[model samples]
Target chain A: MSLHKKILIVILVASAGAFLWMEQQQNNFTSGTDGQSASLPHPGHSAPDFTLEQLSGEGLVQLSEAAGNANGAVVYFWTSWCPFCSASMEAVENAHRVHGETIHLIGVNVTSQDSKQAAENFLKKHSITFPNVMDQDGAVADMYYVPPVPAVFFVDSGGTITSRKTGAVTTGELEQEISRLKEAD
Target chain B: MTEPFITWSVGPFTISAQMLFIFIAAAAGYGVMSLYLKKLHVENRGEILGTFLTSLIICAVIYKLWPFILDPQLLISPGNLLYFAGGPYAVYVSAGVAVIYFFLQSIRKKWSHHSLDSFMAAITTALIVFSLGVKNYGLPSPFSFGYMYEGVMYHAVNFYYSWLFLLVLLAALILVPSSKKYARSITMLTGLVIAYGLAAPFQV
Candidate 1:
């Protein structure tokens, strides 16, 4: 047989084997159900209301009040220890600076697993000027069903959640969400 | 402290750190491969360019197709294919494609084993540069030299591998005698084996 013919046969057999192996792996994952919960507050639902003390200790900030006053509000749940949160804080701060007049940007510190002093240091190090409230006992995070740190929830003027994004948020992404909020108003 | 993810906004487009590093790695690999081949007095340098381009195309197709094959449900849309397809498996597939292409070229062109040595050196240089940008820190260690990933410190395994591969490339270049028969093949095989062996303990 020609060398090209042999190579073709080998390629075909190898591809077939890889396909079968991947299919089997997919089946196993699907059968195991993966343990992911479906309890997250989906978009278009009313955002759960909560009032938490500001990090600066000036006063308490209510989510419903902030959303009602502005075009919309961005409730960002974050922790000082999460590496992604630290990386994403700059983008969130930028978004606030650009759209703070029209949109209320509220950063909620998840203090259950992180120290309050560390969170204050994180804000100071980043030069974040927006209002940040401390979720001291993590009851607010549980109310929102936040799965991870650096989660951003966009809530409209009607207190309805427009969207929920988990993980790090880029400047462009935060801007896009702000634009969407403005358009909804 | 190293940032977990880096990105730059260019007008409407955003370029991630990973994409920038991959581009730099590819360019450096091609340039190094061309220089090494020229040093060995290989006249047909265009073959190296052709081989690299062909391997890239084949790797991309394999990367996109593998996920769809795994779960036909992922074939719902083009966006889904892009989102779900490529990962570590694509690197393995690309390496396999490059090897097969090189083997075929060796047979067809009657190329010397020294050409294979140059190719291996090119791969090592690319991987060394890639390791600098990739986030592959291994298990947590008590050592202070490690990097902090998410509050906890982990061994900078990728950094260690990068230095090891660089040493292998340098040894292949200096220690192997160009005039000796099968010297290039021996150096290439030995460098690869040693590098892989060193990397085995760090693999997650």
Candidate 2:
């Protein structure tokens, strides 16, 4: 066969393999309903678990422990200096106020970039009540891949990151994610 | 799973994975085309370079102007033009415009089938690299090859495209010396269409 013919055969075989694999997987899932649920896509991967001191100086808060307690956790990384973070704080605070009981909303202050006092003051001035953790070394921020301020990671009950958003988010967006988080179980 | 992609900020510019991929694709395309030209003893480097630049300019213009077209008020503030991302629509529009431009240029230059073949090979290579970089895997799939996003495994549609394109490109490159006038080009084009059709169901 010509080189062209061989290449075409390769493509065909690969495509056919994909189709067959998909079909076989589908059949396996259909045969065992529990298997389907067990194999359900674990989207977004597990959220990087971390421990940080609460900004209120109320001892260290471990992410896994907090996540275990709540239906879902919202890990928000922010710096006091960011105007966008300032703007989004109100929406986050609102979400906390409304869904604090069910959702574990933790503010991770990227303190290495900003002064701890500034972050504390920013929270106080905004009248935010949700627990705020100070990532003094920015380790947690780095782990979460938050370069820009106002990054939010919505983690499900299983500690899987259900969704994430970079930059500022609106009240609606926050609530929408919260609802999705509630249902992510 | 943490930060699957990273964007580097250099001065006022932020280079994302997508942008880097596009650059890589363009470079690869240029190199592949150059190689083909050399192989074919074609000396129309200047014309080919012109066509590439023209396509790039057209793409940029279309991307920037797309938002303004959608929201006419955006035209009032020139700086706002920079902020309005054209997204996929801009890419499609730019590609459409570029194709028309290329056709016109091809006719005007009385280009050979060799030129077209080289152009197709470059594009296919570029596309393969770009797709791999972008990681635009489509809907959730049960297949193990699927990419996991947010706890769900999605069909690696981009990977499929890249793989198929690579095969076609390799075939074309290898068969170029076999006196197969336009056969490789036709095969490549046909393969692209078939691949598109096949991948449609898997796409989101």
Candidate 3:
């Protein structure tokens, strides 16, 4: 065989080997034998737990504590200034009103970027009724490594982050993600 | 590794490793295509580059407008077109449109199979870099290459893909002589398809 043919064979063999290995791993995850996530906040991993004061009110809210909801939780990180965040806030609020009974929507205001007063005004202006938390020091934001405002994370009842979006999400998209979370439940 | 995503904040906005890598991949693909054309001494270089640019612009436009199409209410925030692009479905749609555009352009240009193969090589380069940026790892594993997330070690499937695509790119550049025609490109695509099929099971 020519060098070209030889190279092709190598690529084929490697891909086949990877595919077989993947099949085994799938079996492992399905059997609950080896599917545990690290401390990082990516999908398929357990969402790092954190506690913060509610944005508009008193008392603190913890992430793992909110995992008791039937469909799980939606963790939203935002600042008052981001236009994308402002636009998506309506969708988040609507989701909360419709599915508030089944899912926990925890909004985190990156207060380090915005003043407490500004954050409160933005929430009030939008008529957001969900539980909004203040990441006063930005510690929780650091824990999740949020990329820009309007970032959203969906955590399953088991605490694993099912999906995450980095930009503004539509109401339909939120509903779709919520439906997937429900299906997972 | 401990941190899977590398992120940096610019003002109030943060950019992640994945986004940075996507830009890098697009540049690499374009660069590779230019280099390959230069090596071949293709006469219609400007036309070929223009065709590629058209496809890229088309993909970007579709991706940006996809959200509005999905939910016209998003138009309420006209500024949203600046930040939010459509989701995975948008990516699929954009890519499909680009591929179809490429086919039509190829027909119009009457480009040879060898030229198309070279184009595939450029795409392979982009895919290699993209796999690296996305950290598309798979299920728990015992291998040393596995990244420790939380506590379990998962397969670095993206790296696996990158390695495979790198080989394909190298083969496209170095192994396939002009006489070999379409052999390397076909093999490289087939291998990637098979690899993607197999490794998808391991992805999180």
Instruction: Specify the highest-TM-score model's number.
Output: 3
Question: In lDDT terms, how accurate is model 2?
Answer: 0.73
User: What TM-score would candidate 1 get against the native?
Assistant: 0.49
DockQ in order: 0.03, 0.10, 0.44
Q: Poorest 10 consecutive residues of model 2 chain A by lDDT?
A: A34-43
lDDT of 2 by residue, B51-122 (tens): 966776787788657656755664565655444445324578877888678767877898777777877888
Higher-ranked by DockQ: 1 or 3: 3
lDDT per prediction? Answer: 0.70, 0.73, 0.78
Best by DockQ: 3
lDDT of each residue in A82-145, candidate 3, tens digit only: 8889878988999999998888999999998899999989988999999999998888888887
TM-score of the A-chain for all models:
0.77, 0.83, 0.86
Tens digits of per-residue lDDT, candidate 1, A1-185, equal: 65755654565355446434634543464467642222224355467788999998989999989999999999999998876687668778988998999999999999886789999999999999999999989998877755356778999987877876666665655776788899999
**What lDDT does candidate 1 reach at residue A98?**
89
Q: Identify the CAPRI category of the predicted complex in candidate 3.
A: acceptable
2 or 3, which is superior by lDDT?
3
- Candidates sorted by lDDT, best first: 3, 2, 1
> After TM-score superposition, what is the CA distance of residue B121 in candidate 3 from its true location, in Å?
1.3
Q: Which should have the higher TM-score, number 1 or number 2?
A: 2
Error of 2 at B128 (Å): 1.2
